[model samples]
Target: MERFWKPLLHFGYQQAMSCLFPVIIFVSLAITKVIDVPHLPDYDLLFIICLATQYVMYRSGMESKDELKVICLFHLIGIALEVYKVHHGSWSYPQDGWTKLFGVPLYSGFMYASVASYLCQAWRRLDVTLVGWPKPVWTVPLGAAIYLNFMTHHYVYDIRWVLTALLFIIFFRTVVTYKVLSVTRRMPLAVSFFLIGWFIWLAENIATYLGAWQYPNQREAWTAVSWGKLSSWFLLVIVSFIIVAQLKHVKERREEVPFRASRDSGQEAKRQA
Candidate 1:
């Protein structure tokens, strides 16, 4: 029992740490919903809090500079998606803020950034590695298609189910290896993606309850988000994972190049001697 519980506790601790950014965002959302501040609308206040939290995370070395860059990229990507979704009547901010673009609040991007932050933090904390990762030829195009489908589906055919089928086919053999304390664990990459997506769905419910955003059905009165959205989040998680994995792969290759060069130079000198 002691042996089993020890690793479980460590796993929980790491997960909680990885969730720091997300936890902060949710707390801000809840607080802003209840509290009133002079000259600061709730949405703008949430934005300021998010910005400060990001700066502190960087300054205190909670997140590396490269990870921060990834978060920023996701922030912009999320904002673009939000603007499109709002325009198409998918959802609405339903609040006024100077930081809002079109109808979506600027702070909403941080919600997406928190997802990237969690992925980066968990990857580091768990010492995660991939087995049988698909080549970029397969992954890059799939990722691009998934993102584009989010917007195009509104106008053209909704190919989300097709893309999801492709996701399983592409990642079928992939396994994610992660460490929990001294123990290492393995999970199928597809299963991990589903699990993360499900949890994000759960978090979305909480966020909506806290007045983060509202669907058409939720505008008049709060109600559960549609189960159909789970598939959307599942595919979105894959997109985030692919982007981070590609960056990590590129960084590893760049680091290997210098090492290989030095090794070859040493071998040449040995032959000369």
Candidate 2:
């Protein structure tokens, strides 16, 4: 019983801490309708939430300087996609505010930052390591291709399925090793991708339900996001992971314990000879 509860408590705590930003935003938005802040725009309120969230993370040491950099990078990437998507009618922000950037609320980027925050937090909390992770030569180009497809797919042939297949090729052999309490466990990288994507999809539903953004069909009324979006989120998860990996986690083979020291020993012997 202690063994089971220990791991469960660890998982629950990490998940809750990682979700801090999104929950704050969601609750703030829900309350905005009931409480009137005189002359405050909804988008501005969201902007404030974004700022407050970052401040909280920084002050509480929830995010390190490097992690903050990664989160900012995610925000930039997310905003770039948001600009294009909003312009192309992929989605729309119905409310107006001074902080709008080419029709996207400044706070929209926080959504992506939240993902980065979760990745960074989970890595530290779970003591995660990547085994059999593909070489950077393999993952870097694949990540770029995935990001490109998100843009080109709008005008050209949608090659998302092709990219998805390549993701499996690159990552199928990869395992994510993590510790929970006293136990060490491992899971396939692809499984983690799908699971995170599914949870993000669930979160997306809640965000839309909170009026974070509206799809064309949703302009009239709220509806469930399409199931097909799971695939997109799956792909996006890879993109997020690649960026976080490049900046922080996603250890290579040589970075693992015994091998890391062995390689150093071999190098010393070579130098002596």
lDDT of each: 0.95, 0.87
Model 1 / residue 213 / CA error / Å: 1.0
After superposing candidate 1 on the true structure, give the runs of residues whose Cα lies further than 4 Å from its correct spot: none
The number of the candidate with the highest TM-score is: 1
Report the lDDT of model 1 for residue 273: 100
Candidate 2: misplaced stretches above 4 Å? 249-273
At residue 147, give the lDDT of candidate 1. Answer: 96
> How much lDDT does candidate 2 score?
0.87
Provide the clashing-pair count of each candidate structure.
0, 0
lDDT of 1 by residue, 1-273 (tens): 989898989999999999999999999988988888988888999999999999999999999999999999999999999999999999998888999999999999999999999999999999999999999999999999999999999889999999989988999999999999757899999999999999999999999999999999998899998899999999999999999999999999999999999999999999999
Tens-place lDDT digits, model 2, residues 1-273: 987787888889877877787778778778876776779888898889789889878888988887888889999999999999999999999987899999999999999888888898888878888889787899999999988888898889999999988998889899999887757899999999999999999989988888889999899889999999899899999999988887663444336777878899999999999
TM-score of 1: 0.98
